[model samples]
Target: MVTGALAAAGFAAGALLPPRPAFASEQLTIISWGGGYQDVQLRKSFFEPFTKATGIKITEDQWNGEVSKVRAMVQTNTVNWDVLDVGVGIGELCSHGLVETLNWNRLGLDRTKFLGDDKTLDCGVPHHASSTVIAYDRTKLKNGPKTIADFFDLQKFPGKRAMQKGPTSNLEWALVADGVLIKDVYKVLATPAGVDRAFKKLDTIKKDVIWWTAGTQPAQLLGNGQVVMSTAWSGSINNAVKESGLPLEIMWDAQMLSLDFWVIPKGARHLDEAYKFLAFGGSPKPQADMTRYGNNGPANKDAMALVDPTIGPNLTTSPAHMANSLEFDYSFWGDKRDELNQRFTAWVVQQ
Candidate 1:
């Protein structure tokens, strides 16, 4: 009876119901980062099951300039996206009134079952967790710098090193290198002098370091031996290790941990269905399945135990890795992003 009622509601709302509630809605679309094997996992785990269960269709598009797209949609009053996966910095922008605040309870997901009793909230739910780790080619550097400080100490660990070019993570890394405690990251970065101090510290390594604009670029550089040391995404570095036989090691100490969220725009056509899909995607089983294929740990804390042990340890959000690292404060970064970006841009261009 519930299934029939849902099917009727879906038909009346012009929303295609997934054959089952466990499946995704028909004709749903997702916006995500382009490339990487994560999309493949999404297809096999989420999209396929969603289609099969609900008899709903799914499509995905790369979210290259999604902010602009969202803004345009807002201007035209015609939102096209049902779900979006945005970075922490981007999430800050959305939180300022761009995207809708999700109501987990209304969506029928037991928040406690997913994110735990304390962490689950109505605003946004984390989708994947990752870290910025130091990956070094073992053959090239016999004793590569093991910590972020050593990564910045070019004199001792002399070789081509690469760091992310953008303002997002670099400023925090720079502050970390400058002896600011990880817990005090944003507090230090909040001041003009502290911001300058970070840029000044980064200036020392600017000339010798290669600036990587894309995530895959760092992995490619590490694989080709173009750089002996670099800050790389955990999954990308792992891929390099497996595919290219690069004797790369990740230093977990002082790793910058981050979480990405699945968000909905304010005026999406399929809010009800989108919320249902979010809950389904956030479930433990599907999250574990996602990790197996893409090496990304799902956002659900409960899902951690379900992941295969072999891949689980390497995941950024895994218990072992999470213990050694600091969670990137999304609220802090979201708040101070523009100031940091402006300062970072000036520093990068000066290089």
Candidate 2:
């Protein structure tokens, strides 16, 4: 997910949640990117089970990873959202004091058992790791695309291509498709010439590209033949293939792996209850349970062993998938996103 502030014009669009007491409350509100990702993976495993055990009814809300909404809530002291599922901009959120600095002892989970690096775990608990992989419907393309380069080769695999409307994985993938080795993607991307090269490659497909913002659109686009192939979230592709019986297949090469985190907005009313829910959801058991419903890998290290073997190969953490994967450089993006976002938008407007 692209992490940053979004305009909070629709902040009051959802159910108006009643504020909870810090010590005890019957209700605790948590927000995540809603859809099958939340409905199946989170609702079944975390929300429902946590409520059953603790009797804290969860008021679930959905957003598209809008850090600005959280920022607005914190600034106004109307923090109804207790726990947030954030991506990419966590360090900025922590530095700006938009979210609380988590007390690890309060959760009592083993810090070392978490899967992400130290920088990621500093302010928020790791929720799950998902990847942006090249996906296509096998039934449409009998001889399917096999690599990132194929996704760009209009002469060989000609059709409308779908990708999210941003410069996240798209920029990195453009470089890889243009022949930049995965190991040096960030190193090269840091240079001006490399950025121009990535844009130059994207220019080839700009006319053929179909931009999608919602997570659900990619699989739908592929399944319904709106496009021959797309850059889609692995969990969405997994759900379409497993549950909906879509003939979607994923190309894990050059996959951009990203982590989602559980954060508490600074003024969150239900601090105590929030910590309790975080601890329960962050444990090996609940973390592992997420895999039963989607392709995301468990963020708890011990939970990896507990993932059902049947679905293990489909997960981002699977050794086969990780062999050629590129970890999304949060630090680099945190520094460069705004500049690139502007550049990408300006480029998109050209004929």
Q: Which candidate is the best by TM-score?
A: 1
Off by over 4 Å in 1: 1-26, 36-39, 110-122, 223-225
Candidate lDDT (C-alpha), each: 0.72, 0.84
Per-model clash counts, in order, read 9, 0
- Cα error, residue 294 of model 2, in Å, equals 1.9
**Candidate 2 lDDT over residue span 1-351, tens digit each:** 121111121222212323421222445889987877788889998998887676566888988776687788888889889998888877567667788887898899888987666766767898788999999988889898888999999999998999999999999999999999998999999999999999999999999999999988999899789999999998778877878999999989888988888988898898988999889978988888988877789878789898898888878988898889898876678778889999999998888
Looking at model 2, residue 234 earns an lDDT score of 87
Best prediction by lDDT? 2
Cα lDDT tens digits for candidate 1, 228-309: 7888887787777778776888877777777666777778888876776787777777778888765567778888888888
Give TM-scores for every candidate, taking all chains together and pairing residue i with residue i: 0.85, 0.84
| Candidate 2 error regions (>4 Å) | 1-27, 55-57, 89-91, 224-226
Error of 1 at 7 (Å): 15
Cα deviation at 36, candidate 1, in Å, is 4.9
Model 1 clashes, total count: 9
